[model samples]
Target: MHNLRRIRKHLGITQKALGDGIGCTQGNVYHYERGQTLLPEMAGRLIAYAARDFGLVLTYDHIYGSAQLPPVAMAEVVNRG
Candidate 1:
């Protein structure tokens, strides 16, 4: 299983909220947690949302978990909570 669900739950955000951040639907998030991987753009957007809104640092590897995702550069934000 991907860390998407875990991270979202940890952040206390709903699928619809996360999907809105990444420009997807809640159903898409539902499918992503099952097996599908997020597009690089969407992943980056998620990372940004996590940082800007939730003050949580996130990365492609963090989001993909054990999935074989290529490395992508993204700025991480230190938790301000």
Candidate 2:
């Protein structure tokens, strides 16, 4: 299972909100959370959105369930940008 759902919930981002930020629909986000593989373009968009909109950085491992996220400070994320 992808960690999209967990990441979103961890950041307190609603599906609709995340979808909107990434230029997709809530249904698409729902499907992605449920196990659909995200296309490269969509994955890139999602990564960009997390950083730009929420000051959160995300990696492929976080999205694909290969690794767990460490506690990240917003200040560090913003500074990295």
Candidate 3:
């Protein structure tokens, strides 16, 4: 969980910043980063945006402690829109 937060911080983005990018609230970002909740779709969007926009390779292991988020493709599509 701490690692997750560290990654977000490493990106030089505040919770509010991230939320703004993803159409969420800062409190929601805090909850997700802190492991208080799991938002699979939003997490995938964030990872995809980070990778495509910021050159950050945030795999599922980094974001969700698993290597099985298939939402990357969907994220890409959404990003294009």
- What are the models' TM-scores? 0.72, 0.77, 0.66
| Poorly placed runs, candidate 3 (over 4 Å) | 1-3, 66-81
Ranking by TM-score: 2, 1, 3
Q: Mind giving the per-residue lDDT tens digits that candidate 3 earns over 1-81? A: 424576566566677867777778899878877677656787678777677656667776877664433323444434434
Candidate 2, residues 1-81, lDDT tens digits: the string is 567788777666679887887899999999998889888788788789877766677888788767767565666444434
Which RMSD does model 2 reach against the true structure?
4.5
lDDT of 3 at 1: 45
Top lDDT: which candidate number?
2
Candidate 3 lowest-lDDT run of ten: 68-77
Q: Give residue 19's error in model 1 in angstroms.
A: 0.9
Ranking by lDDT: 2, 1, 3
Preferred candidate (TM-score higher): 1 or 2: 2
| TM-score, model 1 to reference | 0.72
Tens digits of per-residue lDDT for model 1, 27-72? 9999987879767787788889877776667877787766433322
